[model samples]
Target: MTKEQQAQLSQQGVEALDKLLKETVENRVLPATYFGVTGPEGELYYSCAGEKVFGKPEAGQVDPETTVQLFSMTKFVTSLAALQLVEQGKIAVDDPSVIEKHLPELWAQSIITGWTDDGEPQLVPRKNPLTLRHLLTHTSGLGYAFLRPDVLERYEKKEGLKGFLEANIGVEGYVRPLLFEPGTHYAYGTGVDWAGILVMRLTGQTLDEYFHEHIFGPLGIGKEEITFLPTEQVKERLQSMAARTSATKGHIILHPGWRNVAKMTPEMIGLQSGGAGMVGTLRAYLKFLAGILKCQQPGGIISPQTFELVFSDQMPEGKQPRKDLADFLEFMGVTDKQQTEGKVTHSLGLCYLANGSDDGPLPGSARWSGVAKTHYFVDPKAGIAAICGTNIMEEVPTQFLEVYSKFQRTVYDNLVQSKL
Candidate 1:
């Protein structure tokens, strides 16, 4: 991007941040907010909380560099790590049978023939086998407690996802029955957590070790640069963390399922949550995310061929729509169209791509939200990507899309008006 264009993007980003902070303070969103937008080369905007609600900042205002816990955002990172393996020819996206050898416990049961999980209603037999593509895109039918409490409770009754996975991959190696058949539905569970452990077993590297060696180290992300502040550091970032979130509303706040289990020992929580447990500044994430955006647009890290391999829809050739949303936004950031008619509820991943149907536009926007309020979108047609992160979780809409969408409209109008 030209320096002049870069300045415009930066100006718009700061302006949007200011507006977002205002909304949060007026009780429109949450108390604190961290947001940013970046291209492969430069950050358009890098910002932090407007003010403190839980306490006061020890220093000046919070820096956008302060780390915020990345909930499901870790899924994208996990996917990237898996992609790296694919690049090395270590794994095949089309083979679910690989789980048979490395994840035999997954095959020990009847393979979840019936259905009780909300994410997977049918629980049909494996649809042409549950390939690596199925797991990465959330079609593996692995259920989580996030949306469906009852189903998660049953899985928990089975000693929770972390335990089930550890038992299977760890010493005992016993696989849990699928709540539904593979490739049948879209449910957000610890499936990638299972993937992270798969990385551990296949490479003999724990999730942390693998991420550090392959991902964090190469990317220049370090202990101080990226943090899921342990108890000790919590006090240091506590004020900001507390400021960034609101009280848990009517549900399990963050669902640290591994909290009581062996996999989530304090140290392990920081290490293995390759699926959910990450903390970093928006700028740091911008670097990681920008690479993904470019790679997805087939411009940054991976080749265009590898991009298609990892993100192309993986449903069985003649399979019916298992997801209500159209495409997995897959780290494209958020989209300008989500609040518009374009927000696809059923997708292969985090993106929406104008699926031409009367069902409307549930398929055109690249969108992903952290289990918490951290949400991202990048609309290729719309020209840029934006991410907003806060530790808060709420049942009611915080009106983030409302403000975000308005900003997009403002920019588009301003640009158009200037042309006139």
Candidate 2:
């Protein structure tokens, strides 16, 4: 944090990013990329690279205002909403009965025991109760089918299960059986979507309304910056989704999801998935993150106590991701080293990975990404929150990870320049 260190970091950051930017133009990771960095003090850096849409020369380039589908990054916003409710004392983070009391329909849930002898679905009653804490920490036993296809197979057997890609957003998509008993496992799932529903049920305001009234409005954000469902106007500002074509070259190709997203109608707005249904500009979303970072200080979105709780470890007591689960997650493009990494854990509101000890992300830092390669990390100790995003389908492809890894190292190296 010294002036000399800041100057060195700035130089190193530019050098590292310059190489990555060239690769981006060469289609190394994405066709379009937008990124921002902030701290409790304010904006640090913001930049964009590549075209707005692949193969559309006349379209445009990315910028701070260019909007992109946040995908699972929406969970950060939903987490904030839930934590706000906790700050208000309307909901208890640790109360097991809070979920059942507000959303009784979830009471009849079952855990996926195993497949039956005839390939039928096997189910068992969950012994432990689902709590607000469980939902916030992803210990509530809910999951997304796209990530874990094994659960998707079981969910497909149920009648009336619709693909949410172009369909209406609803809790029905997440109403499937639990992957394990509540409070027993660490799985990335739709618990936050349910938490969003809890916010609506308690406040009688839609998640959109609740965020605007509480988080956005108080923080001085406009409605245009963050749109849950892509309206026509929102669609206009969106950086088109680029599909990855090759592993080595990061070849640029157009994907159908971009067209589908462009044509999203108002009807698709129903039942917002607090887990995935949201889109916004990089600067706007960074502002929201700045709010979370500011919460580490006094006079922010939530109380300081709540902020500490949000960033602290919330994993099952003395438990980590099972080896099989960690393998499955890594295979799905999410990095998990719970088995090999020392004392790995998750926070209540964010996916707290490693306690940064030696190198890389500082200890107790929280981070997560979207399906389309959008990623963000907040290091409270480092006084830095960085967001790097590209409208590329599939999460953290190898080439993208290479670029991301370099960016992350440069950021941390600059912050702690003495390491060099």
Candidate 3:
């Protein structure tokens, strides 16, 4: 395509994305929503629609600057932090001794075999050692109790431990028994949380301190733009979390769980969860993603060789997605049918889409989403990164996925495929 044609396509793409955002808010699929795209140099597109608080027009308008809880999206940042240490020769991806020495609690976790006759969890010692690769790849056998009822739920309930969200104690809340043996199966759980703890143990700095000095500083991101604890001012720009009451009727209400979380003072939370505890503006996150995109070239945030590892498929044979993860992906409506059939694999930091979709991101792209339906993808081959941000507690509403998938298609159709 000629330069003029490319520019025209880009403009049309922006209009389509803007229309999608407005329609979702108007239709009440989400209270507020924003989408952004970035290239190696800087942001290419950004637009947001709807109010910060639904049905409260005077509250504020949602924009690129609005902060939203990043949830699992925080994992990408934490994974990068750990990878930096690895680059410095402070840690190794496949080495287990480093984790064993630093985070012994993780190393000591036993695999749950089966439940006893009386609802007790039967535990067995792990045959293989736990490695940082396992942690980053979600093959460490750790899982969230709420997601895995058979093992982790029974174990946490029997042990009288609080869930990560309910517990004031930080990483301790995530310390649970393994759902399976290490490096054997994929279970989306607290492995990144443990990896964050490992980073702290190795560096002797709090996760926040480490990030400010290393990750954010080098990327030229302001400390205020992204943080584990949002200040009162930062909180003011936060989009209110909403739940879809009726997708068909276009009804929504403030998400009660998120409302309680919004009420939490910084001091109320004890430790920074690397997996879920992050709040940031879309602009700041786009910069972070842009940095990852730049890493595909030389002398970026991380080495080119290291960046290759980030996209490389980390899963070996027999290490497939667990039932819980498969079910969750099905709910999200992003995965290909073949993904559940064992084609799914994880990269160092994100889910690897091996077979590029017809209407979405290309193959070899790494993608993941936050709990509140905040989604992002970094496509190195396409030389672009994009995010679809929303603050909603309902697990991947159908309408939201429709817009999300369409947004991806629009991005590629105009911004990427046009150039090709």
Best-matching candidate per TM-score = 3
Instruction: Write down the lDDT of every candidate, Cα atoms only.
Output: 0.52, 0.72, 0.79
Clashes per model (N, Cα, C within 3 A): 36, 2, 0
On the 0 to 100 scale, the lDDT of residue 22 in model 3 is 78
Candidate number with the higher lDDT (1 or 2): 2
User: For residues 1-420, what per-residue lDDT tens digits would candidate 3 score against the true structure?
Assistant: 223222223677878887887788887767788888887777778888899888899987887778888889999999999999999999899888987898888788788888889877788888888898889888888887767786788787798987786636776787888877787777788999988998988899878889888888889998789988778878888888777645525567776544355677778777788998888897899999988887766777788988877897876446345444455577556556644554557888888777755556777887888878888888877777889878877643777777887888888778744343
Ranking of all candidate structures by their TM-score, best first: 3, 2, 1
Relative to the true structure, candidate 2 reaches a TM of 0.89
Residue pairs in candidate 2 whose N, alpha carbon or C atoms collide under 3 angstroms:
355-363, 356-363
lDDT of 2 by residue, 200-238 (tens): 899898878888888888788788888775677778888
Prediction RMSDs, each to the true structure: 6.4, 3.5, 3.0
* Candidate 1 residue spans exceeding 4 A from truth: 1-13, 26-28, 52-61, 111-128, 158-176, 227-235, 238-271, 296-300, 309-323, 326-349, 352-365, 380-383, 407-420
Q: What is the TM-score of each candidate against the true structure?
A: 0.73, 0.89, 0.92
lDDT of 1: 0.52
